[model samples]
Target: MSAAGPLPLVGRRVLVTGIANEASLALPIAQVLRASGAELVCAGLGPTPYHGALSTAAEQYLGGAREAFESTVREHLGADVPELIADVTLDPSLEDLAETLRLRDLQLDGIVHAVAMDRTIRGGAAKPLLQVTREEFLDCMSASAYSLLALVRVLLRAHVLREGASIVALSYLGAERVMSHPYRNIGVAKAALERLVRELAAELGPTFGMRVNAVRFSPWSRSKAGGAIPGLEEAVAHAASRAPLGNADPASLGCEVVHLLRPGLGVTGEVRHVDGGYHVHG
Candidate 1:
């Protein structure tokens, strides 16, 4: 232990997923985890063999996303940090990631699930729930909700996630309530994500000794996804005004996540609010 005392996550390895760019919430979370002395392995969405025959536009978009993710990771997290491309919506892509980790003999102590996507949200506007199609709904659900279960299942099957590992998923208050902004399809997916956290926590805790939890953060508009939601800026302003402690920043959220990720917390299946008392209002 140094003068500052022993790091809480010293010698632990964590997998941080869904880093789309430098403004991503996962970036701050990963920074906090590393500051606590954890070794990090990062995964970002990119084209995979499973995608199979993407249109030129789709390929270009994916390529740009991957490039941004790579640049952000290299600049902020360090070039040596292991980077893996994964499209959690694809089972084979997830399996490939697990295989790579397994081959490297890495056992993760924690996982940060920061991935969420909604095709129904476009051009800073969200389609009404009634307007959402089955395909759009399922696509949102698969990426934002089911991906958590899929990732954990693949990692567990590969024996890459160690016993007692902690898993934290990023969520929002919209999961449980209608927000001033249109959450629509993503809200439903978030609800499922939170439910999965509880169910997985109960099963994994008793059977595998793993912990699963989620953090609902403030109405942030800095990230790409957050900025794309119509009326989110207004929501952010309203939340800041109403919240007792104003609003929680990314650093605060990061700290909360790292606290949950710490070993032997005896906490699981919790939908924690890191939104500065915003979730308590009527």
Candidate 2:
């Protein structure tokens, strides 16, 4: 142990998913896990440094773009942490992810599910729920909500998740209630994700000795997804104005993640709030 005491996540290996850019929320969480003494394996939506990990579909999804993803890892996640290319929507891609980790012997102690996407949430105006196509809605749901199940199952079956491991996913206030702007499709998905967190917690906790939880953060506007949302700026301002401690920052969010990932905690099935008391209001 160090001078003070043992670090919270000493000797733990963590996988952090959903880092799309430097602005991504996952960056801060990954940083915190490192600070807490956990080794990290990062998975991003797009390309990886290893060409063997990219399939044809993954290539298409990336739109042949590499610079942006490359920069995110280099600048934020560092050059040492192995950044894997894993798209939860594709089973084969996930298979490859497990294979890659297996070859490298990356048995994880924790996973941060920080990925969410909604194609219907464009910038011009709010796409009405009625106007949203079935394909659009289901795609949104699959990407944002169901991907958690897929990712976790594959990892588990591949022997990636170790015993006594933990999982944490990012969510928002719009998941359970209406907000100032239209969060329609993705909000619905977030509700499903939170529900999955509870269900997974109950089942996985007993069987695998694992814990699962979700954290609902403040109205953040810096992310690619949040910045795309209409009225997000206004919502951020309003939330900060109304919140007792003001809007929470990414550093605080990272701390909460570390708390959840810390071993020996019986905490699970919880929808923890890191929104600076914004959830308390009507």
Candidate 3:
């Protein structure tokens, strides 16, 4: 046979969420998608201009989140990449995102759900699940997991998703197993996220011919979220040692995302692992 030909993502429009900085997992995924010939839109978390009137330091901190994210996108995907500010847990921002895409005459072929947050996870330590408050737990769930449902709801309402679109969410092994690092609050949220993926896959696949899946990536302790979890670096080193293929890096994660989002894959509701056989150990 001749060459395999052009990249699978040629002409596809993909919305990639969770870019806060260059170190973000979303950045790598976005880059891969773009390289595969997809048009990209990036969404970063917010302390939007409307959050208004802060001290200079606060303004710089918040503004830097957006700036860093956009710069990373531009550096890799070029100046034309759409950049949006969104708080997926908030309906208003989600609506705005849908409107933004409509105004640009874009309909998404795929979405990379990379957003996740947990207030209880700190720099040097994370609060135990026993010590987590009700409000904190709910906040974690809403941001890290339920936001997927909210995003899909709003996007569908706006008809932003194509009839047979695909979706992939980033996840971790902590969703199903206790780990060396403290995964407490967010682990529960991830379990819910995985279930939501299956439910969405089952529901959307039949009615709209869409597919949704989650990827449990190898533990890499360098990204913003990964660095927040105490002992994650140690766990990363440990996992790399035990995993049959060693630690799967962000590029590997990106490659798998491209594979999942490709047209006609027909795989849905699966929590696929990209951790190089670490998941099989247990």
Candidate 4:
């Protein structure tokens, strides 16, 4: 509705996950996608009710993250839209996802996988991954890396996504190199996630005609997840100095993901860096 007709993503059914607030990368992507004419279905791990109903466990599981999550969804997509309870850590049931999509009566055109976590068992706190415990390493990998595979597998099984569906996940430069404060096993997990994206491009491209990729983002404006990091502000300032654009902004990355999700692009199975070219210079 920007006076240029419906956005390119208009009429597309896109599902996005891992949104915690209005500033979250996923929400920005959803906002842009919706503006461009894409219908959206937001999935989150929060315990918000669906259509005025919630399981006892869900109410407890959402813990303290529910209110913010609900408010965020309302801000981005408005109230009264479908928001599903989904945990990327668990293998999502295709039937459940399909049933939810059926309720919306929208064909899946793209998926955004933004789920991630670190139990801090890494013990390194913000230290490098080499110092982390095996449990910490695997836990991060399961939450950040393997979840992409699970999501795509479930969607593929359910035949929910249409051909040319784009799958995107978020990553960071630390996944390939070392940072001063260290982020435990997150770097290794990101590397693994990128690898999986490439492998999935090969495995699913021909079979399902879908594309898989990840965006490597630098530190950005603060969020609850980023605030948990010990020296995030310093990291952002450092990246800004080295970055071509002199800053890392989530909005830019959100726009980039929307571009990848749209049709008429040949990019597939690649890790697109939207970090102000910081990855290249640094």
Q: What is the C-alpha lDDT of each candidate?
A: 0.94, 0.87, 0.89, 0.76
Clashing pairs in 4: 7-36, 10-37, 126-182
Identify the superior model by lDDT, candidate 1 or candidate 3: 1
| Regions more than 4 Å wrong, model 3 | 1-3, 49-60
**Winner on lDDT (1 vs 2):** 1
- Regions more than 4 Å wrong, model 1: 1-4
- Provide the lowest-lDDT 10-residue window in model 2: 46-55
lDDT of 2 by residue, 1-282 (tens): 246687899899999987777788888888878888989898877654344566678777684434565578778767888878776787778878988898899999999999898988776467888899999989988989999999899889899899999999999989989787999989999999999999999999989999999999998889888899999999999999999899999989999999999888989999999989988898
Q: Decide which is better by TM-score, 1 or 2.
A: 1
RMSD of 2: 3.2
**Index of the highest-TM-score prediction:** 1
The lDDT leader among the candidates is 1
lDDT of predicted model 3: 0.89
* Cα displacement (Å) at residue 198, model 2: 0.7
What is the TM-score of each predicted model, taking all chains together? 0.98, 0.93, 0.95, 0.87
lDDT of each residue in 129-158, candidate 3, tens digit only: 899999999999999999999999989999
The order by descending TM-score is 1, 3, 2, 4
Question: Residue pairs in steric clash, candidate 3?
Answer: none
For residue 106, give model 1's deviation from the true position in Å. 1.7
